[model samples]
Target: MPSNKAELAVRIAAAQPGDSVRGLFFKTVFSLIQQHAGPAALESVRVDALATNYSDLRTYPVQDFLTLMYRAADVLEATVGPENAVFHACGETGVTRYATGPGMLIFGIISRGDPQKLFAGAQMGYSAAVSYGSREYLSTGPKSGTLRVRRDMLPPAYHEGILTGALKVLGLKGTARAHAHDIDRVDYDIEWG
Candidate 1:
């Protein structure tokens, strides 16, 4: 039999990237958890909301992604628990904005045991091929972007926060400094357990 963490890792790793925006988001979240939390921690944690932007492509329209995300949230609420679940959507504008093309997908899973805790969160974006500023439209514009997303899931913010907080709760500390890239942003702080 696989260890608890290993089992969790398998469950997460087994998730396939569906043919929609949210599929990638779930895959990214699962991958990140596998990378950072290891098998044991994963087994200990329970995922509350597995929100996705797209649920059905055939019957559901593309613009209705937000609605579908809400539906997914409902599913999570019903499957997991109602009190601790959250579902969010972002478009090409405002705080939830992304690049011009296909926009991005953001989803998060709360910790069942600790409502305030976050097990994992993820954001993914895809840009279609397009032309820009007198330049010839390249067939390959922006493909996709993936990363672990969390609101205060880490140090300087612990269990009371999100995924990083859950990591802290599990005793995963940051030894390196913070850094930002044009494509991504990462923050790190020391941890002790």
Candidate 2:
């Protein structure tokens, strides 16, 4: 829906209050910006979002996180073009880093390399990372499923990208198609081989 940073900023400013995200998310987004758009771009985003001192153990308002996300998207678009793909790539990097992190290593081992298992645990992961919203995973068959997310404020491409990244980390090739019902709700139909 929002094709540019200005529109995204307006939407984020009006988002419902009370939700907060783990500061680790800010770091991931900053890393992505620094890698693709350079440190200056990253610094610009941090200043714009007023997120210069984000810490992994703290929580920050979701609005601030959305501002960072929207700003990061703009920088990525400027540097990479093909806006949606860049946002998706940003989401992938976020998930890939988290999945490979020390905290999530046990979940991966417990999943026994099954993407479905990893997907089914998405709600737990999401809960740990944010203070609001919900994620539900539904299995359609042996290699297909749907992920329904509610009340999440992230861009749809980012959510779909998480699904793509999740499958990749589990060594499966998959596709995730986002069906957004609004900014607040989306369902991602996913299949893997």
Candidate 3:
């Protein structure tokens, strides 16, 4: 999995040189900040920790990306409200548009957000499709499934919003409930009928 991730990062770097692992996310994030917190506040954001150039397509330490994201979450929570605002903030701004071309076409053919197929894609190292630190398929029923997304390092609010937005994009009516087993992991019960 790590190899696959590294390969993808390499491809991304090659495709868009002078960009960070954050890639398109950098512009979108700043745009969101500007909208939610005003341009002045956006300017105050120290994005340097993530990378010297937000537009630079260079491989950066994953921890730096995480720190920048958590800080963005703080900004959104304070400016946009705490209830998954970061997710909604990004979702409403068309973050999933990043999944362009064949990648999304396949997902669209799968009837949008089918957990089973999505999981398969993630297992195949298609993190852009559906990502988690380390996920385990716990229980899958005819109409629902449970995904144990370990590495609760990132806030659930972040995932919850992204999950909801992704499902919605696929035209799937679903609800996700996140259970924090420990600070290190979370169990998400995603239900659809």
Task: Pick the lDDT winner.
Answer: 2
C-alpha lDDT of all candidate models, in order: 0.26, 0.78, 0.53
Query: How many collisions between residues are there in candidate 2?
Result: 0
- What is the C-alpha lDDT profile of model 2 across 1-193, one tens digit per residue? 3247765765576467778877777788888889888988887877745656888767888888777777776778766556577668767877887776633853567567887787787788887777888899999999999999998868778877878887888888899999988877889999999
With a 3 Å backbone cut-off (N, CA, C), the pairs that clash in candidate 3 are: 18-56, 18-57, 19-56, 19-57, 19-58, 20-56, 20-57, 152-184
Hey, what RMSD does candidate 1 come out at?
18.0
Candidate achieving the largest TM-score: 2
Least accurate 10 contiguous residues by lDDT in model 1: 129-138
Cα deviation of 154 in candidate 2 (Å)?
0.9
Runs with alpha carbons beyond 4 Å of true place in candidate 3: 1-21, 55-59, 87-95, 101-106, 109-113, 125-132
Instruction: Show the colliding residue pairs in model 2.
Output: none
Residue 47 C-alpha lDDT in model 3: 50
TM-score of each prediction:
0.22, 0.88, 0.67
lDDT of 3 by residue, 25-114 (tens): 555666787787786667666656643565423244444444555455666667676535664556434335544532465456553556
User: Cα miss at 39, model 3 (Å)?
Assistant: 1.8
